[model samples]
Every structure is written in structure tokens, then in C-alpha cells.
Target: MRFAAALTAGAALIAAILSPETALAAEAHELPGAAMSLWWVLPFAGLLLCIATGPLLFHHAWEHHYGKIAAFWAALVIGPLAIAFGIPSATQAVLHALLTEYMSFIILLFALFTISGGIFVAGNIHGTPLVNAGLLLGGAVLASVIGTTGASMILIRPLIRANDNRRFNAHVVIFFIFLVSNIGGSLTPLGDPPLFVGFLRGVDFFWTTVHLLPETLFVAGVVLAVFLAIDIILHHREEGAPKIKDPTPDTKVRIRGLANIPLLAGVIAAILISAAWKPGVSFAFQGVSLELQNLVRDAAIMILAFTSLVVSPKEFRGANAFSWGPIAEVAKLFASIFICIVPVVAILRAGLDGALAPLVLLVSSPTGAPDNLAYFWLTGALSSFLDNAPTYLVFFELAGGDPQHLMTELASTLAAISAGAVFMGANTYVGNAPNFMVYAIARHRGIKMPSFFGYMAWSGAVLIPTFLLAGFLFFR
Candidate 1:
């Protein structure tokens, strides 16, 4: 009843604010970003803080009521926005986010989650350092093809099962988060949400593949090396101690659920088609416009998700231990995030003339050129805590919103932003969605995964130095 009431009230408020007459009027008048103050960003800050702290401090309450908490923040932002900028402008902003950005973003994630959930890796191997490194390397390569979430879901259990006999294997999962969940996703838009957002905003699909290669290899290689060294030492220690009986003895690895592989390919094709087949056709709702290709892509992805559900054996997903909870949580939280971020994106677009002029100045050199290193670090620092997708959008706009200009002239800056957002997401479990999912799955399988701070300590010691080296070599 409460959920229904909230939904109805939200719909009513949007209807009142987005009435056709008001929308038309609001189109003519715009929010003055220059006049806006940092206080305007408080709601966005509040929402992120809640996301960061809520699960840690109040797990039960946060799990049940996170959607409501998100809605509360969205209402706070929307009501003030409607009053201050007039309902039309606010309506247009909200519609633009919902109809365009949020819709595409969530749909792609849903398709990836569902399709990947259907494909289970069905084998066990010994957790020798060489075998573990091979698994990590394979997952890293697969991440760019199947997405970090997809790759993680398919490979995590087998990796866990492989290491089930090992005494010192928590580090293996930690390094998996660093490599498979974050760094490996650098090569393609499908690999990470930030890159996909870049793709949707007009960056070419292969741009990340070509541009981020050096950084990705460096980070992944270094992390893999570190894992190998640690695993060797741990293996030696285990040899000295009493041998624990192995569960799930080694066997030739085999791939299961091959049917969903084609569906996963279909999802990739749909995105590619959307990017290439722009009919220039669009549908308008109130003040929002949905382009033909984007609409087609989203519908295709939905169909693919449904097809996977129907055709893939139910036991495949069951063996994979798939559940809807993660995707549901993401959908609810990001709905509010997209809504609350409207003002923030606008302010950023406003650039030096906007309320965030100080931030704008920080990323620019005295000669007015962007500081690429600053772009990498700041984007990375924020991405380490906040979600990386929105953080990427923020910096992408700060560099200037012209895709052509960014791709042609300031390509390094764009690469830096993409790398920072994708790679540093390993710095914390909450830094990226897959990081936490992998952690949860490992914990559920009885791995003594580190505490939140304990995990950060791992990242701080290993990843920070590695990123610094890569940034100096590549971004500099």
C-alpha cells in the first residue's frame, strides 16, 4: 500500500508539473546555473551519502526502504526545482533524464544482468597460483566481451570453488575485484556503465577499445603479477601446514549454458545497431524526445532479456545462484540518482559561468587547457566512492560536451576520464556495482571477505600505487 501510494503521488506530482502547457512554457525559460549555488547540490550529496552509509550502518532498514529513501531525495530535488525554475523547466529536466539517460542506462544493465545470469561456468580446478592467475586473466579478458558483471557472475563461483581448498584465498577475491570487476572493463562500453554512457552520448563504440588499451594492460598486468606473488607465498605456507581435504576436486573445465551466449551476442549487436542505424526519427513526450535507434536498442535489449529467461534452463540460473535483488536495488537507486543529478549536470554544463565555476577552474590550466592529470585523479577519487557513471558524465561535460571535439582534439582527456572512472571503481566495494556483488557472492559461499575498511586497505596498498604508475605513464 505504501509503495502504491508513493508511486501514485509521484505520478501525480509529475503530471501537475509537466502538464503540456507548462512544459511548453518552461522550454522557453531555463534554470540560471550561474545564479545557482553549491547548496543546490546538497540533495545529490545527501543521496550518495545515503547510498554509501546506509547499507553499512543500517543494513535491514536500508535493504527494505532504500527505494523509499531514494524517492524521498528525488522529491526533495524535484519539488524545489519545479518551484524555483517553474514547473515546465523542471518537468523537462526530469523527463529528459527519465526518458533518455536513465531508461537506456537501466535497460542495458538489466539485459546484461539477466542474460549473463543464464550462462553458468560449470567446472572446478585446483587453486594453484598458476591456475588462479589463469582464471583471473581469463575473467579479465572476458569482462570486455561480456561485461564486468557478466564475466564476474559466470566465473566467480568456479573461481571460489577452485579455491575452496586453499587456506589463504581472500586475497584472490580481492584481486579479482581489482582486475575482473574494474580494470578489465576498460576496453569496451559494454564492460562498464561509464563507458556506455559515453557511447550513448556520441563517443564511438570502439573509441575506448583503441584508447584505453595501454592503461588497461598496465593495470591488469601489474595486479595479476601482484596476485601471482601473493598466491605463491600463500601456497608455500599451505604446504608447510596440514593439508586440508579438497572439496570439488579438479576436473577438466567445461562451459555450460551455451544457449545464452548467442543472446549475449544479440545484446551487443543491438547496441551496435543503435549506434550505427540512426534514422533521425524520434518520438516526443511533453518536452522529452526519444530517438529511433535508442528506442530500438532498448526494446531489443528487453526482448533479449525475456528470451534468455524463457529459453535458458531454469536450473542454469539456479546453479548460477541468480536472484533479482541486485538489479532491483540498482533500478530503484539509480532512478532517483538520475533525477537528482539533473541540476548537477546542468551546473556542470554551465562551466565557468555556472555555480561550480570553482570546480571548473580546478581542472583547467592557467592557459585554459584542461589538466589531464587532474581529470584522471579527480574523476578517479570521486569514482572511488560515488558511482562511476555519473562521475564520468560530470567530468565529460566539464571537459566540454562536444563529442567531436573531445574525440578529435582532447582525446587524451577523454581517455583519462574513462580510465579513471572504470579502473578506480575497484577502490571500494561500493565503488562499482559488480564489486559488491562479487563480494556478496564470495561471502555467501563462506569466504572470509574483508570488512569494508579492510578491503579498502587492500586496495590502498596494491591498487593506489599501480594507478599512480599507470597515470604517470599514460595520462601524463
Candidate 2:
């Protein structure tokens, strides 16, 4: 019966996509009007189907391999939809928006250098309370500048490697996600993709920091306190147990590759340049106004920064122990997300495009807040399971319709989305792009990581209450 219903729905989507009204409108740009109506639901269904098929598909595989299956299913569903409905030119516009308008490369490059620097100087500082505290602190701070993914890739493996001698370190990584990977991205546009989209749409960049600072600090402080308590308890357990003689250190803790400071500065400059570039042309392309200046700026900066990274030497990354695996993982997962969600994004764009005023009213508060922080939390919750970047763009375009509300509201709401997506991602390994990558790498090295539901339990116990507190404090 369910299969029959899905077939009917699929047929209806085909008709909707091919409807004469849409076809004529989309002909010039080849925007795949026929595929747009049902794009969102298809991948969503595929995600669920993959979850449902888990037992049959990877029964013999390790539990962690479920994500690979999920990624596969998502891509499989995306391929047919792309062929049937994709408009390459419009798709290029979307990609341009993603790359240039959002300045994603800026964030990626910033993360590369920042993570490398953190690893280079602090990589060996593990196993002691001081080192753990520093890592947690450094990770939190870095999360704001480089993003949760950047911070996690640079830190998680080294952290696991450092604490290999301890039996009670499982919970440490769990809490690490809460603080460093998820919650910390709340402060700036570079911290989370959703907020960056908001910025591209005209939300003031500085306001993001000002509006979200309080909530971010609160979450970080609480998570840190919880982590410390757990660490103390675990540290004693290890101390009381047997200890093996340790090998002597080869070199002291002095910072190596200090000369890379210029390269590091170059990375930051590249990010600033990319982000500071503004789109000058605002004329409509296929009925949608292209923010050309902003797009140009974002694309240029990202290109330069990444190009610099490609040209730099191996010695500059020595202490950081930088490698390609984590970034490759991020690229793979994001590729899946980008392709699978394209239809969904286009569908949402079409649905909400004509209904902007009403949609804004529907999402807004009684005060007619230009944008509501409440919507951020709702989207963020769903984003924990789905993809947050496109989810962010969905809400961002919705918010762009209203120009009358105070700019502060827009900043606050965008910040809320950023916080919610990054933080709640700790709820499940699959919640954020890098969460599972960290899990896979950690487990491969023999860390006894939590299961999907197990991670959720941790989030429920620790992060959820904190997010609720943030909602009351900020969203209201």
C-alpha cells in the first residue's frame, strides 16, 4: 500500500514538473520545472528508505558503515532526478551562489590553516587534564573561526591518538562534539554555512557575532563544565589503574614551522578578501535577481586561498600533522548533500517564491519580527537529520522577502539557525558532515565510540537542555 502511494505521488510530481505553466516559464533557462516539484520529498524519502533498508544492505558490515549506505541511496535518488529535471545553467547559478555568494571556500581555507596551526602547536598535548582542557577550549574558539568540521578534523584524530592509553575517553569525544563541532559555530558567519547564506542575503556580518555571543558562551560554558566533571572522574580511574613506562619525547613543545606564519596570514587574508567582495550587479537572471558583486567576491577569495594551500610546503604543516582524509570525507559527504538536495532546494525556491509575504508572516512573531529565531530552531532540528546548508538557504530566501523589519532580527534568526544546526549535530553521528568522519577515523584507531542512538542520548542529557535555555534567552 505504501509502495502504491509513493508511486502515485511520484506520478503526480512528474506531472507537476511537466505542467505547461512551469515548462514555458522554465524553457529559457532549462530549469527542469518538471523535476522541481518533487525534489525535496524524493531525497527525503530516499533517506528514510536507506535507514529502513539498513538491516538488509549492510548486515555483515560494521554498524558505522550505515552512513556509507545512506550516502549511496541519497546519490542514487539524486541521479535520476538530475537527469530528468536538472537545468545545468540554473544549477550553475546555484553552485555559484554556494561557492561565491556564501564564501564557503573562505571558511574552508580558514579551517585548513587554523586546524593545521592548532595541531602543529598542540598536537602532542594530550593525556593530561591541562591538555584536554586546552584542546576543548581551543576547539571551541576555532569552531567560531573555521567551523565545526575544520576544528573536528584537526582535533579528533589527534585527540584519539593522544588518549589511546585511557579506557574512559569515550565520553570525552562525545562532549567534544557538543562544544567544539556543534555549539561553537554560533558566533560568526564563517562558523556555519547557514549563517553565511544569511550574510550573503544582506544580514550584517558583525551583528551575527553580537547577537549570538551570549547564547554561544552559555552553551560552551555549560558543555565545558560537564566535560571537566567527566574528565575528572575518568582521570582518577586511569590514575588508580596500572601504568606502563612511557617512551621519552623526541622533541620539546616549542612551536615548529613558525615560518608558516606568513602562510597562515595569507590564509586569513584570503578569507577576508573572499568575504569582503561584494556582488555589484543585482539585475534579474531568468526572473531571479543575481547578486553578482557578492558572488564575485566570495568566489575570488576562496579560489585564491585554496590555491595557496595547494602550493604551500609540507614543512609548514609538520606540527599539525595535516592530512587529506578528513577533508576528502567532507567533500564526499557534501557532494552527496549538494546533488541530493538540489531538487529540494529548487522546489522550495519555487514554492516560496510567490508566497514570500505570507510565508514571512507565517514564520514571524506577533511583533512582526523581520525574521524569527524560533524558525531557526525548527529548521536546525530537521537539519540534524537532513542537510543544513540547503536548509539554511531555504529559510534565507524566505527571510529575504521582507525588507521592513529591523536588521537585528535577521541577524538573530540566522545566528539561531547556525547555532542549532552546529550544536544539535552532536545529537547523532550523522547529524553533521564531519561527525561521522570523526567517528569512523576514531573507531578505526580503536576508540569505543557511541552508537547513533547512544550519541542522541548524550545530546538529550547534555545539549538539548542547553539549547532550550538558549531559545528562551535569545529566541524570545
Model 1 CA deviation exceeding 4 Å by range: 1-31, 165-169, 197-205, 234-252, 385-387, 400-405, 443-454
Model 1's C-alpha root-mean-square deviation from the true structure amounts to: 4.9
lDDT of 1 at 456: 90
What local lDDT does model 2 show for residue 312? 48
TM-score of each: 0.85, 0.73
Q: 1-476, model 1: which lDDT tens digit per residue?
A: 99978866775565454333443435454565665656668888898778767767897898789999999999878876775567777788888889887888788778878888887776678889999999999999999987888788778878888889889999999999999998999999889989988997999989999999988898899999999999999999999998878877556777777888999889888887887797889998877888989898899999999999998898878876688876777788878877877777777667788777776787889998989988998889878866688789889988887888999899999999999999999998778878877886786677898877788999999999998999899888
RMSD in order of candidates: 4.9, 6.1
Q: Taking the tens digit of each residue's C-alpha lDDT, what string does model 2 give over 1-476? A: 99978865775565455333544534444344333444346665565445434434564572556558557755454444433434554455455444533335335534453435343443344567667877888888988776676677667756765676776778878877777777777777677666666665656777668877887788889888888887888898888889744322334445444444454445445545545665455655444455655455445545544554665455545434455544554454455555555555555566434322243355666785644556657566657776666666666655663422435445566566566666666676656665666665565566787666667788888887877887777776
Q: Would you list the clashing residue pairs of candidate 1?
A: none
Using TM-score as the measure, the top candidate is 1
